[model samples]
Target: MSLTTEQITWLTKEQISWFTKKQTQTFTKEQISVFTKEQIQALIPQQITYFMETQIPYFNEKQIPWFTTEQIQALTIQQIQTFTKEQIHWLIYLQIQALTPTQISVFTSKQVLAIAEEQIPYFNKKQIKAFTPTQILTFTTKQISAFIEQQIKEFTPTQITYFNEKQIQTFTKTQIQALTKEQIKEFTPTQITYFNEKQIPWFTTEQIQALTIQQIQTFTKEQIHWLIYLQIQALTPTQISVFTSKQVLAIAEEQIPYFNKKQIKAFTPTQILTFTTKQISAFIEQQIKEFTPTQITYFNEKQIQTFTKTQIQALTKEQIKEFTPTQITYFNEKQIPWFTDWQIPYFNEKQIQAFTPTQIESFTEEQIKNSPQLLLRKEEIKSFNSKEINKYNLNNETLSSEIKNNSRKL
Candidate 1:
């Protein structure tokens, strides 16, 4: 016989155990809805497990969120699917944590959006993996904030791509650092733009190296402006090599001092030519010493013309000695006059040959006298005073030796 409403209400736990599953199923939703809250709480897991999914709405709304893990675990997939958005929002952390991955996967996108912030941190990786792309994007900023580094890192790149800008901006520095290189590479340009200043440094060299040029170009002006020297230093030469001139210029000037010789040298000629006077001077002396002659060639004559004597003379004696004749010819006299007396001796005959006669005349008498005789015209030779000619005459061993000895000290 079908269960009557009054009889169903009177059945004690012990008496309910005697009912067949089919007899229990026969209880109408109207009869079940009238049960006291205490009666619903008292139901055994096995009894709760056997309730027709159609009867789920009959359970007290207040009882839904309070279900113990054992009662929750007994819930059929059909019953789990019936969870209201309000029910999903009210599930306490421990209760949410207890939902099987399969049960979590059954949640609709609307239900996923209703998940409470405090409960987000408790989802297992298996449940996280089960989330749909649409469901993942529904996570609120507050929900994302509670995510542990490990929990956030396990999300697939594709799943991560679905995050809204507001959600992405909430990533903690540790969570940003926890991203794998490949996963980091998958960030959309819009998502990448939201990386706050504090989180920018959290990217490792490997993660920085994986960024696509298009993704990097979308970084906000302010975001690019705050990259500390150490962060810029972490970029791969190949990564840094792709920087556009405007993009390169956006790097903070204080950070400019940290560029290593190789990094400075890696800049394209067009990139170098774009430097403002201040930017040009921002290069550390070590970087200047490191500049390849080819890199120096990219500088306009005004830049070359304006270089302080100390800047030119600060180059290593070997680097000065090795300058291509063409590169030496590019230096203006104003720059040339500043060359140290020590640098005078390092210029090879070929480099000296490239100098203009005006340049030839600008050198100290001693420099002209010591130079390769082949480089000087007879007119130029006669231009030197008798004392300079005496020093030039190497066959006059005593005077030449005396000049050479003094040159070593100079």
Candidate 2:
């Protein structure tokens, strides 16, 4: 029997579910809009398959979840855009997954944000790329965390820039690792500060290298500690120069040897002073040679003592000259033997005087031969073999003239 539009609105849900496809198709958009929410929800998937594009927008919020996945897939782009935010939010994960990329792209920002967390991974790359930056910002942290790697990677640099700090922190390490270098470079310093220690090390070498100086500066000490040697090696010299003293201290000792000469040289005196003894010991002879004069001067007594003999020998003549008398006195007696003949000449008179008699006696015969300006005290001079002193003419007037010339250079 044919029911009038008025009669249809009054029908029970069970009665509405019994309607044939031909019967449902006969309903007009105006007639559909007047139907009871319960009656609309009762329409079976088979019956709803006959819904005209004109009738699609009539589905109100309360009736939205009752639409089956097959019916949702049938929606055209124009029909999808017609749904209210409340209607969009009511869609189950299955129904959300049914949307074509073209249909998903047409959703308004409000509708896009209304999607549930469980529905987030249903969006394919093209669907994710279609979201505007404004829409991307509307996503809750829960929804952001639910995104799969592919969806996370699909975000354009401009879209990635709009993620709030909370949303940025919610990304899984795998999702973070999936981000393109362009997207990584787009993060602001404030957003960068939100990453936890576990997430920091997941960045690829290229992604780590892509970080801006400001962004690199935002990493907390805990986050800085998590960086791997490979990632540490990727940091540009300019990025290295901007690290705060506290952040510099957080660098892992194992990563110290990975720094290139340029990165090693970029360290400021304040930054150099922050290295632990263990980190100072970790530096290779090659890295030791790259130290700036100011950096060499800043090493604390404890740090100076940690250097290996080979590292000690790697110091340039200018670096050797930069050592304070107090720092020179801190070196181990064993380390005194590592000083080369040329390096010995760079020691100022005060540095020479700072050495203990044992340290002075530890020096090689070749070192004493080249250090014509070295002025040992009576007891310190007694510690060395008289034959070596005589061979080097250590007590001669040439020592006095060499000291005068060295004083002129200073």
Candidate 3:
């Protein structure tokens, strides 16, 4: 016959130790609840395994920590599942470490949340992986940060998705750097937004490339400013296209050339306009050639003036055709001669007419000869001496008549 609750409560600690596993299995929840802490401590691992689910919750915090690691580990899954949040929190360090992956895997979200932050890191990788996303979400920021590198690697992308912004923000820079490319790619755009500026630059080049366009768009100007050289270079054209105008200005001058032609062309006109003169000068000839006419028109006077002869000469006719008259006058005398003979004709009459006298004189005779459609203002023609005008093959009478006729229309 089962012992009554009153009789069970009256048992001595020594008497509790004498009970067989068969006798332990017959104890009711009421009988278990009446046991003194001293009596509960006397139960062996074998007796503990036979405790019914209904009896396990009756163990008070004072009684719970008395469970030896062997007794804790030996508990049936049903008995383990019966642990109250308070009981889970009361478990000692050794008791937590004793849990098998199978036992850890069965923890309800509340049970996972009840784990003491100090004991979180004791879980092995297998135990870490065994947690469902629901359980993963229950981990406090302190508990999330307590994870070692090996434990962090065990988090699958699916499990990582459940981590709220606060949990993601608790990651150390070292932890951020330790993320594999695949793991880095899996962060949701919202999750990635929680990464602090200090952590942003620590991402490896491969990890940067692994970011989606949506993730790239989510970066703040502060985060964009901290991206290292290789990380900036790793951004794909699609990723580059999403950067805000403020973010574009955050790119360092030294990093500007690392952008490939397609990446350079990915900037919107507003973004293009934000490029500093130093950044514009960083563009290689190939990158210069990639700028759309609308993008070319967005360059400020300083930006236009900073272009090297090689970059200026590299601009396609379509790009040249879009230059404003103000932009044309911004080019220094040295830059004038770099324009190819073929490129000269694409300039509108207003553009050709806008060049300063020094700029007109800088043009080579071969350039004048090859560009039959090149338009020169009457004043620009007067800047050349007669011998030079003869050498340039200007038909003064015919040009004078045409100039007079053009002035009449104006």
Candidate 4:
């Protein structure tokens, strides 16, 4: 009774086991002697199946017999299909050593789709890479979509470089659009370059708009500023605007008391005119009544030029009249000659006549030249010839006149 191919194909575990037991008991030395290794190899499937049924226990047990690479390769499609996952894993382990391209293609796709997810990592490199186009296409849209999304951040440079443009473009618009701003942000510089080279538009305006505050903060300053500039109202105008009205007002208010001559010069004429009379009055009152010596020194150095001559004159006269004698002594000792000059114009003829020569001698020539009060009292100091007075004259005169006078003196 010779077995037909179909009968051999359909041989059950019971039939295979019974035959193996009977052969072991009944086959004589002379009968085995007639078979060469090739002849025995042809007969071995029956023996192999018999041992698999009788010797191997349940599939998941660790005690299962290891199949030779050649033996696994010889299994029929039906045998391969019927394998439990553990049995399949065993077969895959053996097959990886010697599988042909077609067999690898067939088995990798089947295992990837059918193997327990936990077993996925056990797949060999060649097996993983051998997945066919058809096998890749068979994945559920979500599964394939997730691979693309994860790859944007997780892929190594070599992996990104290896993906073909068509495979990259296979990601649907919705899939690409689904990435969060955070996910987009995690993309490596290499991945970003790859995306650009492939011309894949991974980020959409809605995705940009969806960025969290922390994500927004993570943007490079240039990137953030450019985005804000392009979308002007995208950020709060008070903090983001180049010329924020609030910031300007705050700086102006804070800086006013300390504004120096150089700083006053830096202000436009418009800024000069913008301060209210009340602010000027407040500053003058604060300086005369409350400012410390350190503050007065700062004001003399930094704030004097911020005032017009008329404003200075008014502030000085107000200070002299309102300040205590001790405060006036302190102010004079600070060498703020401007105050003394301003007070001169307000002196009556009787006040000038009342001044001692020492009091008149204390005045600088700039005080005499620029202050109407000082000019009116100048005759009282007519004999003044101090170096301090002359220096003031040199400084107040025209540059050419000072240069000519200095040359003549030399």
Error of 4 at 177 (Å): 22
TM-score of 2: 0.64
Model 3 segments more than 4 A misplaced = 1-22, 25-49, 52-78, 81-102, 105-110, 252-262, 265-380, 383-410
lDDT against the true structure, per candidate, is 0.71, 0.77, 0.78, 0.42
TM-scores of the models, in the order given: 0.76, 0.64, 0.65, 0.24
Could you give candidate 3's per-residue lDDT for residues 1-410 as a string of tens digits?
37788888888888888888777767776776677867877878788887778778888777787777788888888888899999998988778778888899889888888888877877877777788777887888888888877778778877777788888888886677777777877888788888887677778787898888878877876788777777877888788887877778878776777787667777877788788888888887888888888888888888887989889889998999999977887888878878888887787876766665566678777776766534446343564567865676655444445455766665
Which of the two candidates, 1 or 4, achieves a greater lDDT against the reference? 1
| Tens-digit per-residue lDDT, 199-231, candidate 1 | 787777777768887777777767777677676
Error of 3 at 210 (Å): 0.6
Superior candidate under lDDT, 2 versus 4: 2
lDDT winner, 3 or 4:
3
Q: What residue runs in model 4 are displaced by over 4 Å at the alpha carbon?
A: 1-65, 76-78, 82-86, 89-92, 95-98, 108-111, 137-410
- On residues 1-410, what C-alpha lDDT tens digit does candidate 4 reach at each position? 25443444454545544565455334443333333333334444445443233223233333222444565555544445455546555544444445444554665455545544334444454554555655554544344444533334333323333444344455566555655555555444333333331233344655545444344434442333233222322333222223222222333232344433333333332332344444444343333334322333333312343444444444544344433322332323224454544465654433333333344446677666755544544552443345645577633223224433454565
User: How does model 3 score by TM-score?
Assistant: 0.65
lDDT of 2 by residue, 48-139 (tens): 66676666767766567766666677766666777776777678767777777667667887787778777788777777877876778778
How high a TM-score does candidate 4 get? 0.24
149 Cα displacement, candidate 4 (Å): 17
RMSD of 4: 19.2
